[model samples]
Target: MPHPNPDAMAFLLSRRSRPAKTLRAPAPDRAALEPILTAAARSPDHGKLEPWRFIVLERGALHRLAGLVEERGPDLGQDADQIAKAASAYRDSPLAVVVVEIQKSSEKIPQIEMTYSAGAVCLALLNAALASGWGANWLSGWASHDRAFVEQGLGLSADERVAGIIHIGTETSAPPERPRPDLDTITEWVTE
Candidate 1:
């Protein structure tokens, strides 16, 4: 016999990511967010490599990031809207967690596996935030991909990559439920 946790399942089924732009103030306090980060850290990591780390960007940090985006814009040939969109994540966000994938040199654990673990951490963080009653969204723009931007903006190392920027805050409006994948089309049952 197996015990089923219906509430957890129901919550998973109903979880929807709130838009980053629509998230407002009064984000999770340190006490409130600590547990969520703990939950996120519980994500599966093969061989326990722990190839990921998080940078919590609060209000002032966001402003600094926004300023960096503005400063780096022209050099990257980004126009106003593009620059604005890149900066908007910081400009509007009350709080965000930058999931950084730190690639470790290991003979046993492959780099791809490390990358996957980092990705898992990103989703775990997002889900944790949502489960904790905070609106959260994962975002990565051109700035996130730019080498200079990552190094200068977030102080990432050569072996590190941005897994995602998980923005968390109060939800201003409820987003309508979007379409889900058709299980029949996506799944295949095999029998011998």
Candidate 2:
């Protein structure tokens, strides 16, 4: 026998991501966030290879990362607007959890499967944050793709890449509901 949790199901159906810019303090403290992290860790991994990691960026770290974005912009050939956009993520976020994909060298699990596992972790973290009563958004910008930025800013390994930056904080305003895909148009039922 299985017990059904309708509230959880409903929450998943209605949950929306709050814009990172609109997220304000006070964000979840370590004690409050631990369970959410644990929930996020429950994401599927084909070979039980935890090929993902998280880096929690607190207030000071955000400022430092912002400065790194500004400093690295010229070298990366990023225009002023692009630099500002990259820097703004740190400037605006009250708290951010950087999910990193640590690609494992294994014959059994394909590289793409490892990437997929990392992607699953990102979504899990986002959903966990939302379920924990905090607004959350998963983001990645040009900064995420720049090797220098990843290495210097977050000290990521050569095989590691930024999967997402999960920003969590209080919602300043509710985001308007957007149109969802029509299920019938996307789903198919097959019977033989």
Candidate 3:
């Protein structure tokens, strides 16, 4: 029989992502964050491709990206509000881990699987932060997808794109529990 870990199950059931906007300063330094990143790297990768990587954005780097967004927003035909929202995330965030998805060409392994691996890395990073008693949230906005913005600000290559930006910091306020999807509506019991 498989050994049961009630504590692990209980933690998973209760884990909730704190809103990125609600996160505060005094973010984890490199030494403190290394373990979290290491934990995230353990996410599943089909065919052992390890097709994802992390970019740790510290406070100064975040501000730089914020400036890039401010300059590029107008060029992208983004409204003032849209630009503000895009820049605010970077400017306000104490720390943001950019989960970059790299599309590797392979015959045996599909590109779709690599994309999935990148997505999994994002979630794993968020969960790791939360499990370590830190506020965390996974986010991706228009700025994240814009080629110019990503290339100039984050320096992603042609074959790379942002899967998610996982913000980690101290929680200022406890977010209220939101509605959850009912299993009856979303699940299927196919025993045929």
Each prediction's number of clashing residue pairs: 0, 0, 0
**TM-scores of the models, in the order given:** 0.97, 0.96, 0.98
Off by over 4 Å in 2: none
lDDT of each: 0.92, 0.94, 0.93
Model 1 residue 118 CA deviation (Å) reads 1.0
> How do the residues 1-192 of candidate 3 rate in per-residue lDDT, one tens digit apiece?
899999888988988999999999988989889999999999999889889889999999999999998998998899999999989999999999999999988999999999999998999999999988899999999889899988988889999999999999999999999888898999988998
- Best model per TM-score: 3
Weakest ten-residue segment in model 2 by summed lDDT: 140-149
lDDT of 1 by residue, 106-182 (tens): 88998999889888888889999999999999998888888988899789999999999999999999999999999
lDDT of 1 at 87: 92
- Candidate 1 clash pair list: none
User: Candidates 1 and 2: which is better by lDDT?
Assistant: 2
Report the lDDT tens digits of candidate 2 across residue range 95-165: 99999999988989998998898899999999999998999999999888999989998999999999999
Report how far off residue 57 is in candidate 3 (Å): 0.3
